[model samples]
Target chain A: MKSEARKPFSKDIIHIENIDQVCNDIIAKLKMDVTKNLQRRGAIVGISGGIDSSVCLALSAKAFGSKNVLGIMLPEQDSSDDSRHLAEKLAATYGVSTLIEDITKALDGFGCYERRDEAILRVIPDFDKKVDKAKIEIKQNIAENIPAIFSITVIKPNGDVVSKLLPAREYLQIVASTNFKQRSRMSMLYYHAERMHYAVIGTPNKHEVEQGFFVKYGDGGADVMPIGHFYKTQVYQLAKHLGVPQEIIDRTPTTDTYTAEQSQEDFFYQMPFESMDLIWYGWENNYPAEEVGKVMGKTTKEIENIYKSFERKRKTTEYLRMKPIF
Target chain B: MKSKNDVKTEIKKYILEASLSDVKDVEDDALIFENGLLDSMGLLFLIEFLGETFEVEVNDDELNPKNFESINNIVSFVNNKLSVKV
Candidate 1:
């Protein structure tokens, strides 16, 4: 067999040129994965108005027919109103039926807010959960060779902002409490899927899956993940090709789990998806750091540091991707 | 006020307890993270422990993996911070 030539690493390395063919292939795989492999009648997609979920919903509609697909909107108290509005618009555009399951009460019953606020109070003694907004973010860029130091930020009702380095115990507790949102949403998705004899579709992209950005047994639990292989940039391409809502395609991706409005890049990824996608492509394909650095307008050492950061995340989060052992 | 030996012993004890691992032999230069002895969360707890036990502030700039890769590196980094304080 002749050895295949490798393409040069560049900014366009992750671009999907033939989107129609890609969508058709994905639709076929989804149809087979759900109908043949899982014996499911349709797909139940938890739409969040984000690009990845929107694309997944659109593709599910195409795979199982719009009438067979059901979109579930699981929103909590911290969820942005625009998320629900955009999700409704997305479902309407795809002609799929949607169910609004307000998970705020469920999360409240789980003490999600109370526990998370308690942890926040450890770092910010005066943090008032009733009127304050809080979020956690990494302190430095991933391109630097520094350990990621997560910090908590609180905004008071009067526009006063307070930020401090989060201690280990408090950070762990806050994250554990906030994770209820994902686990709750997952349970809701499974309930709808099982009741309707449908498969739950996962909306995680490559970075989310590879970097372990998702919660274990939470958003990570899915009957089928149609877009798990595509990078964030490629997901955008699929969204455009699938006629996803313009507003959704244009909207910045958010964590939506935090009370304060936080971009997905701020909460995780530590960089723009565009840059991350290209650099990850280069690193995964074993391109030299110098070559990637030249194209990215960064030094070779910076590219190396980013690669190291990626490796560290993958190594640390490996547990999230593991299955049960006997 | 603690010696380098004391720093090393404390870090090793923390690593073993935090990891919950059965490995008994933690060498002076063993790569804790690379060897899967501790994880990202464990690293955060270790940072907190070092700061509180040594009474030294770990600046954001000093949070480099190289400074905490091994027991030897952590001892040196703590001593450097202590000397700066002195």
Candidate 2:
């Protein structure tokens, strides 16, 4: 590990200038594409009150008209109450038509919670079903040279929490089970879209889409992706320009599908969004590890390890980004 | 409008393009989902493709595995829906 002191970097890492112009350009492109290519009059976005969805919704409203852009609030048992409230608040603020779809029944129909619990039990032997809560996280240990490891944390009723390393089978089960929520919401979106002759819009940002951080066919399923090109940092810029709610703007990103309040940082990317944006941008641009390390106040070895971790994730989740194999 | 055979060919092309598994010569009667040739996400793409290609509404209820189990099933489903539209 190196000291935290480092020299100034050359330029902005993931910052975008002329935020309004860029935002309007994105909106114009989405509008033109939807009207001409898709031949759809309107767009539908699932609003989680997260920055990504909020930006996408605002763009869609600007592109297709507030009356044409439908904002869907998909909430399940594990979803935070704030998710619905904040999403509704955004829809109202934007004058966009909104609907709520309670996905608890749909997730239950697929036995999502039960399957997830079964997987958790494999890692936490004495994990209580009633009062114990659990969440899974992926971590990279550069010192140990381990690219990725799945870990489970079980919080008992008495406030005792224990963490255990997960085997591949248990990890797979847990992820597959948690993914049911996204798929249920996607199904509901398509149901409404088909009836209304509207197109479904996906809200994945640059990091999630490029780094393979999404569940295939679940949250990844959409007729069009309006914000796939913007980095997480750029998304916040767009959100500010779009007048997204301040509470939504300041909220930390969370998986929100798990029973526990797990952050996207702990669950997937080992670094926070700000650092990740710079690291990923540097890596993608083929900047040397030493240079990136100097810029980010880390050692060259640390930067190299982060690049390795990113590639490992990309390779393992390549299937999510693939076209049907021939 | 294209014939059902043309529709089958189009659907076959989509399955071949969207599936990641090595299914170069998938049988029309083969169970695509059971054989792991297609998945939930693939099904969603197929639904979108069908909706766009046939101009038929594919609702959530029609996303059953039976409707997408094989090329034959997809062809029949599209034809049935198109017939109703006509």
Best by DockQ: 1
For all candidates, state DockQ relative to the true structure: 0.42, 0.01
- Clashing residue pairs in all predictions, respectively, total 0, 5
RMSD of 1: 2.7
Name model 1 segments beyond 4 Å from true.
A1-4, B12-38, B59-61, B65-73, B80-86
Give a tens-digit lDDT track for model 2, residues A67-180.
Answer: 998999999988988898899889988899899889999888999999999888876789887877788875434322234456788888888888865655677788899899
Interface C-alpha RMSD per candidate, 1 decimal: 2.5, 15.8
lDDT of 1 by residue, A225-300 (tens): 8999999999999988899989999999999999998999998889999999999988877888999999999999
* Cα-based lDDT at residue A240, candidate 2: 86
lDDT of each: 0.88, 0.80
What would the DockQ be for model 1? 0.42
Candidate 1 TM-score for chain A: 0.98
